[model samples]
Target: MSEQESQFLLILFGGIFFAFLMSLFVVAMVILHRQRQVKNRQKLEQIKSEYEKTLLNVENEIHQETLAQIGRELHDNIGQLLSLTKLSLNSAKPEKQQQAKEYVNQVIKEVRALSKTLNLDWVESLSLDEFINQQLHRIQATGFCETSLQSDHSFAELKKEEKLVLIRVIQECLNNAIKHADPSRIDIRIHQNGKVRILQIADDGRGFDTSQKSSGSGMYNLGKRMETIGGKFQLSSIVGKGTVVNLELPFSV
Candidate 1:
């Protein structure tokens, strides 16, 4: 070939080689992007699966607790009422028979209430505020401590699973206070600020140190449960002052 022809051929080959390299780069970039997408999708699926499993476990725990509570009520409360009712009926006096009739009616009411608890639907129907009030009432009924609830009554909507977890956690906190704190008063406050909803359970009990590692897994498990529902658990305490547990749930409206 002539010199100019050789130079032209060299230029053409260089241009083709450059274009081939560019095509290979584009292909590699596309493959890399696709692989990343697949990985992200798998990670999301795993997270979703774990969330669902946690929800199921929470539900089961609540049901089991409710059943136990029902058993106690039946044995402690209703059984006594029935025994009194039989005695009144046997007396044969008009007033005694009337008292027995009233006892029968009260027993019916109590039985109906217990039956409702057997179904888990009540968990779905109870609002967070209502649940707090009910729990406080139970504590107060025991005369172990004074209980109060301060709420705006405006609560953010929460999933049933989230509410169940909160209920269980609060129950545990109350139980701990009753068992160890020896507090004269237990207070619960619920409030909503924009997208954030908070529930604070405070007790004027003998508080413990939060800095030291807890020997029990209760606190750790409570934190993990809150994290699963995109909420936060914070407990603050002082030796003589009191202990306060703050549970925060942030959601978009």
Candidate 2:
């Protein structure tokens, strides 16, 4: 072969080699971009989880603070005023007006009785099963309606904090029942599967349509709290039959 012909062939081979190198670099850049996208998604998920935990903690602190303020008002102010009112009524003795004073005293007495029962902290340490039963006993004790509690077996070893949350959820449902439906009976049941604890609270009260459920703050809070712990919350209600609240928590050792 001629010397010039050999030089041309060498330049052609070099160009082809350079093109392959550029193609390899482009492929590498594409791969790195994809990996980075995946990493960003994972980080976003972590951030979301952290934000939810922060929200939950903030809500818990607020609830505690509010309850403490309520306790202070009941014990420090209302209690003392009621006592003073009762003392004056007793000091004044008139047979004709005595009955009216007695009625006033009675109202104060009833209000005082209610002050001692407002904040319930015992639920903070109760187990899931125990908490459910406690709520039933409470509602039943009122004598306004009967409450029945049943459990399939032990709960899924739920954390004490979560137990309290679920207990609060049950209590809220009961309160709504009393306030709205005036149910004759309320039934609460618990069940556990391999990795989920199920709580069902049903009341034979005049149920309202749950179609606009997202508007109720109490129910929305219940759902949010349960979801923060990898749990599920459901509500079903019929205008005449009853309302049913279902909560499911994933079992974590």
Candidate 3:
């Protein structure tokens, strides 16, 4: 072969080799980008799992606290009242016997109502709407506030975990309204549109400014909890008017 031909062949092969190296480099970069995405997605899933577990623990604590409070009320207040009623009925004269019987009947009625509150199994057995209504009834029974619930659809489609998160969110909202808002009336409404479920809680209480940053973590945590469940939380408040909380959740069949 001639010197020029040899030189041309060498140059052409060099160019081809360089092109191959560039192509390999591009492939390596693409692979690295994909790997990074996988790692990030895995990290996000791990964080979400931890959050859900923590939230479940918090809910269990709340349940225990409620049970303890009920236990104390049963032991100290209701138990004593019932005992007194029984004693009065047993030792009453004929003229006072009728009044004593009426009083005992009233006590019996109160005990039966309180018994409903003591049933923790309702958490698993009842639908979300039923559970929410029960909580509202408990609030009204305390004579602290007038509470009402309206639902356009049932929450039987929700999974157990979804229901737990929702119940916690509802309880948190209720606690905030009762402890801070000092509302006379609280209303909860639930409805569904397509695959989205909506819950709105409104209180005719002395509301605060939503624009102002507060030192409380209740609102922040509530939003985070909803996000963990792939839901959205919104709050609106007007000073001296009222507050409304809207939660939207996506349902899967």
Candidate 4:
């Protein structure tokens, strides 16, 4: 072969080798990018699984707490009323028979109302607005604070799981306000705009600074619980002005 031809062939071979190397590099980069994406997606799924597990545990705890509260009310409040009614009946004279009859009727009514609360499955049956209003009634019954609920729209279409999570979340919010905030008044408002449903719980209590670090798991759990349901939780508080919690959830989801 001629020397010039030999040099030209060498350059051509070198160019082909460089092109192959460039192609290999591009393929490797694409593979690596896809792997990273898969890893990220797996991580998110794992996190979601863990969050859901935690939520289940939290929900169970709340259920137990609620049962305990009911037991107390049954024993301390309803039980006493029944005892009084029984005595009133036993002591009835002809002159007081009408009064005793009225007292017995009242007791029957109270028992019937309390019986309705004993059924936990009512959570599945009642509308979200009714459930919340019941909670507000319980708070008022306790005389811990004055409570009110206002809904611009009714939420009758929440899924079973959505209702469960929301029920727990609202219970936690009210419990925190009553236990920690020492609020005199608590108000819950529910409304909808377009495709979004908004729930706000506001308290007139001693609030804390959100920027400051606090060792409270309630707030952390609240945020995590919202995330699990693909919702957003926001809190705003001023030292003495009180605190308000804002939750936004998609109506369809």
Best by lDDT: 1
lDDT of each: 0.87, 0.73, 0.83, 0.83
What would you estimate as the lDDT of candidate 4?
0.83
Report RMSD for candidate 2.
Answer: 7.2
lDDT of 3 by residue, 1-253 (tens): 9999999999999999999999999999999999999999999999988887867776686687567767877787678777776767787487457766776787688677667656455557778888888789989988999999889864667766677778888888898898989999999988888888899999999999888999879788878878877899999999998999999998875
**Tens digits of per-residue lDDT for model 4, 1-253:** 9999999999999999999999999999999999999999999999978977966776686678667877887798778767766776677476456666776787688677667766467677788899889889988988899999989864678876677778888888888898889999999999987888899999999998899988868788878888777788899999999999988898774
Alpha-carbon TM-score of each model against the true structure: 0.91, 0.62, 0.78, 0.75
**In model 3, which runs have C-alpha deviations exceeding 4 angstroms?**
19-23, 30-34, 76-78, 85-121
**52-127 per-residue lDDT for model 2 (tens digits):** 6745664475366447646765686567666666666666567535665665666577666555445444444446
TM-score of 4: 0.75
In candidate 2, residue 203 scores what lDDT?
A: 86
Model 2 lDDT, full chain set: 0.73
> For candidate 1, lDDT tens digit of each residue in 145-176?
89998987545477777777788888788888
Ranking by TM-score: 1, 3, 4, 2
